[model samples]
Target: MGAQHDKMEVGDLKQEANRASPVNIIVSPDGMMYDYLNLPGRVIINEEVGASGESLSTRKPVKIEKLYEYVSALRSNSFKFLLREYEELCEISPQCPQTVGLSEINQSKNRYGNIVPFDHSRVRLKPMMGKESDYINANFIPGYKNARAYIASQAPLPMTVNDHWRMIWQQRICIIVMITGLVERGRRKCELYWPKPGFPIKYGLVEVTNIKEEVRLDYLVRILRVKIGREKSPKSRHPILIHCSAGVGRTGTYVAIDRLIQEIQAKHRNVDIFNTVYDIRKSRSMMVQTVRQYMFIYDFHLDAWQIEGDPEGFKNRKMVERQKELDSKYKELTSKDDLMVEQKATYDLYELFLMAACCCCPFLFDKN
Candidate 1:
């Protein structure tokens, strides 16, 4: 009897083990390199993903890359699931503005003109808003909580250089992002739009003063001062203008990154990069052009958590959606003619009591 009991116990243990999760390892890549996470043994690349395994590090507001991984872990599927979710969402999303002509105001500069901001989202240059002038291919993409709102535009050409500055002045812009180099792969990408350090440049009524330039391995950040040199009242919206060769690839990527960074900072483990990008693309269809660029946002956030151990509004949204489904199901169950007929006597008595009670205590029922 003891031997047989031991054998049964061993069989039960094996069955439970079989039911456990098979993904003992998690892998995440940040464009250049990969980080592996081991769950069963608590060893990732021979080092702990987080040394303490608690939210020990008190990083300020948190960074996007790290925040993404923290939330991914909370979802229990890791970073891979996040990337797959984004890819599937984008793949299923319908490509809008089906006709190419609907997006383009100028046909010469852009090939297959990536839409000039949607009419509702377009930033009209004050100088050309009502005047007879070609449109500046630029858009204002609003981010979550109004964080990192941006105006994405193409690299200004020689003829449209003044128009680009006009858009900046009209929008009271502050930052100018030049993602593509002046010349890339022996091709002229964008005209030098900013003024030389000490020498201020003029374009129509706008004056561009290069205030600061911070260089990085991936991209450049330049602070620009655009003054109409005529407005009486002060407006505090210094909208950022981002541009690449065609204002589609790097331009969109940078814009999306800014929004993600701000959202992760604001919401911590609650924000969704996929939905954020989707919102931007709704306004400017070409934002975050490639799957690789989209994946990079996930990688960027994952890497932010690499140095230290880290920490779901996303799950709550899903819960709310599921609640809606349950509500509909309940409505169907209660409103069916068969159910009403089957329980008419009991339900009618209950309704009578409810109505009488409501009449007796008016405050118990909603007035509005």
Candidate 2:
């Protein structure tokens, strides 16, 4: 009875913590649930559902009403695409790059150390002193053709917290997108890297002031303005560093959404989410980690993007226009949070738990 009572008490607390705020209000699609990623709520699928594949003969844009259908097609076609992109893509080994003073496998987040960042796009932190390989296990991923991409990294351990801030300061980051907590299930996911709101915190050469902090049901978005004195400022741009427990599932998922929205703003509206994931994995070995995470990209993209075409000269202009009016969003309205997605969802009408190949293949059924 004690354990049972404890469970009930915990459930009640989650409900209270997740109670809807004005920020939680959202609209979703029919037969779909509310925004699970951005909104605070839960939906459990009682049973699995499937959809018959439709012939997709052309790359021409589909009607906005058929956005979900388009997503299904892209999903069904993902496996074959993976097979084709296998050589230059896919995870091989979990090994971190060897640096001075660190053990061959030290500071690695996982047993095999399989998901290391690529050399070409790795973020090199400014060393504290002397001679030690300033490695913190982070990757510098390039965004789509035009959008400024982010640094996807694992949660900072207690020791590496200083190096993490050093990287942020060296890079002149404008936004910090943290997807996991300091701890989860009695294990440490990330350290307390920043000061609480209304307090000034200094990490290494970087001085951080929390501009604003907004709590979301699915994640926490903090607007931060960081300054690094006596260092070269490349450009005062919005460079985001997204981190989570493992730094694959949630980190990759958020970056994918932001990049896709950038493409949408550029009028390249018909998005191939699979290709985007493939491109991201090129920089970080095991990005968009799980089958569930891949499906999440679909949910977020469908919810955020509309099929309607913007007028000529509308490149990335929607953001500037929406910022003045979108007060509920807190930060700039240029993120995935502003889009309309189903606020509640349970089981995937499409398969979710299967491996990448199986889940991405065609799901055949009566289409007539």
Best by TM-score: 2
Query: Which parts of model 2 are misplaced by more than 4 Å?
Result: 1-66, 72-112, 146-148, 210-235, 306-368
Candidate 2 per-residue lDDT over residues 92-200, each given as its tens digit? 3233343421346443533124445566556776676556455667787778663346788877776677788788777776556666656554556678887767786
What is the TM-score of each predicted model, taking all chains together? 0.55, 0.57
Q: What is candidate 1's lDDT per residue for 247-315, written digit by digit as tens?
A: 655666556655665565456544366666667877776566544355545443443323222323333
User: Best by lDDT, which number?
Assistant: 2
- Candidate 1's C-alpha runs over 4 A off are 1-87, 94-105, 109-116, 128-130, 210-225, 228-237, 307-368
Please give the clash total of every predicted structure, in order: 5, 14
Query: How many clashing residue pairs are found in candidate 2?
Result: 14
Q: How accurate locally, in lDDT, is each candidate?
A: 0.48, 0.48
